[model samples]
Target: MRIGITSPVVTAVPGVHSPWERGAGIEELGAVAEAADRLGFHHLTCSEHVAVPADVAEQRGGTYWDPLATFGYLAARTRHIRFATQVLVLGYHHPLAVAKRYGTLDRISGGRLVLGLGVGSLEEEFQLLGAAFEGRGAVADDALAALRASLSRREPAHHGEHFDYAGFVVEPHAVQERVPLWIGGRTPRSLRRAVAHGDGWVPFGLPLDRLREMVGAASLPEGFEVVLSAGRPLDPSGDSDGTAKALRGVSEAGATLVSVSLAAESAGHYLEQLEALTRIADAVAAEEGAA
Candidate 1:
């Protein structure tokens, strides 16, 4: 299975993020991006949250780096590693807007963009954005359809239940003929949505057994990627065997791509873990090659 960095410093979750991330800025983030690009990590992810509620911020990780700005900078710095949104809340923006903006980004990045989208769960955020909270899932479904019809086309057009547009010209549309779309959620319905409207499913907050059951039950199409997490942050620098086992276990759990999280205490320490994990990944690949 291909491995991608879960990406640090971009979102400083209270318990999961390193303490050093609180003070780090784009410089540090860029450094990590450059290193990740050079080290052969398949992709680097950044999630979106315009504003998190103060009450939920503590638990949900208040500091969400804007994926567009972050990816734009990282794109300029990196050569090949893809930029994934981990998820951009679909209810927050118009499909054509997404197509236009990310299409420009795809053009700039030479088509190294993996669009991750979600229907969004926070009702308050939906209200804050003046977006429809009721029947949002259905709207999101339509939006996904519109997006599918729109992305990568200059004169894109679509007619859906909630959204209908035509004759709009989007210059510098996505470079890739078909940009990869990954739906994000942690439920069976989310899996179905991904199957119907996206290229992959990225579920979070589920145990390995639950994930395995859901994946086994689903009718995933050919080339439909299931991206499972590498579980807890891996301490490959301290426990190489444990790290290797966790990585392999994620692959065995039916993941076509694994989101590898590294445990570290500081920025420097994080880079060390990144390097260590890369070495472990390389060794794993070599071992598989020899076998």
Candidate 2:
């Protein structure tokens, strides 16, 4: 039962954004990455959005850092921690382009990259990017196949409904023989995609029972990951025992990797919360080991 963190202070959401995050800069982001690495977190994830429409900016909050660039920056700052895109919208970019960007990221990060891909929900953003908003599921399915082909070989080729390319080598091929591809979402179609194509399932906000049901339905291969969001702050008020219980429940519920998010007022507060969460995770792991 490994633990990962959704990178804090990078995406600003109303009610979720800490006051200090508004003033935070790149250095602060580096500090958080470094802290997650030092604290033994399995992975640090960043969200992505090429652009947010003005009408939805109020609800979505318009401050999304480019995941590829952000991860590149963090790669230099962290050693052991894996970097992930919490969910990169597959319909927004060409498959080969994504393959190249993330493949290079994996190469530079020493094979520590988890590609969490999704068919995005924002219709307006899709319109802005000129990516077909409707039939995005089909688009994502094709894109996933194309990405698989492209990332696995130096001279890759793919012929799909949306993309076609061949005989072009993607240099500096991914460090991992097969980069772990995680599909994200809670929809039935999403679950099917995970079972059919993904190396892992990355589901957010699903209840424990629902998570177990979904995992049972999927015919995951051996070592296939089920990464679930913890769905709440581990220590909302510094309750380590409570945090441990919550995490243990998640592990028992069949989450191979649990992603924990913390709400903090400052970098210092975020680091403190991370340390507390790490202790709770370690305790849970120790008990599991003993059992």
Candidate 3:
């Protein structure tokens, strides 16, 4: 199983943010990215939100970094680790714009980009951005199709309900022939969308039994990834064995990739937790190989 991390300190959720993160800036973010890279984590993910409504800011902890800018910055610093937008709201921007931004990011990052996308849940945010909120699922489906076309070819073309363009060249095509598009969300419509359009599925807050059922129902192609969030804090010192066991369970439940979040108070603490999790991942791989 591949292990990835939703970068700490990047999106400061009330409980997830470390004490040191209040004063932390790009330097601290770089340290965390470097540590994950050095420790052999598969990918480092960032979240996105253009603007948060005042009512939701408290719950959402409104400090989201632009994924393109953040990943572009980290791409220069890390060599092996991939950069992912944990879930970019596809409805918020034009498909060509996303293609231009993230496709270039993939080229600059040496093809290490995974475009994790979603229809987005925030009605108010969509309203603020002047994006239609009612039929977002349809919008996202069309957007994904347009993005696929735009990223795969130098002279890209697409004709759809939401977007239409042809006979125009989109230069600096993505390094990968097809940048992986992972759909995010756990709704039935989301799962259907994943099976139909996604190269991977990223489901949040899903229980093990439901995950198993969903994975079984979907007709995933060979090597199609089921990426799951660990959903709880990972504490290396308190329960290393328990962490391994939980991850092993996730692996067994049909997840090809697991993104873990660690509870840490400082950069040093974060690195230590990453090292411990790396050990756990290595052990899991070894055991799986033997099995």
Residue-pair clashes per candidate = 0, 0, 0
Evaluate residue 45 in candidate 1 and report its C-alpha lDDT on the 0 to 100 scale. Answer: 94
lDDT of 3 by residue, 1-291 (tens): 689998877887877777788888898889889989998898999888999987798998898998999999999999989988989999998987887788899999999999999989999999999999998988899998898888858788999998999998777778898799899998877878877887899998789889988888777898788998776778875688888888888887889999888887788888888888888888888999999
Cα error of candidate 1 at position 93, Å: 0.7
Q: Residue by residue across 50-106, what tens digits does model 1's lDDT show? A: 889998997997888889989999999999999998999899999999999999999
Q: How far is candidate 1 from the true structure (C-alpha RMSD, Å)?
A: 1.3
Report the CA-based lDDT of candidate 1 relative to the real structure. 0.90
Model 1 Cα shift for residue 69 (angstroms): 0.7
The per-model lDDT (C-alpha) reads 0.90, 0.85, 0.87
Q: What are the root-mean-square deviations of the candidates from the true structure over C-alphas? A: 1.3, 1.7, 1.2
Q: What is the TM-score of each candidate against the true structure?
A: 0.97, 0.94, 0.96
Query: What is the per-residue lDDT of model 2 for residues 199-244, given as tens digits with 9 covering 90 to 100?
Result: 8888876789888887777677898888887766556347777787
Error of 3 at 60 (Å): 2.3
Task: Indicate which candidate wins on lDDT.
Answer: 1
Model 2 spans > 4 angstroms off: none
Worst 10 residues of 2 by lDDT: 231-240
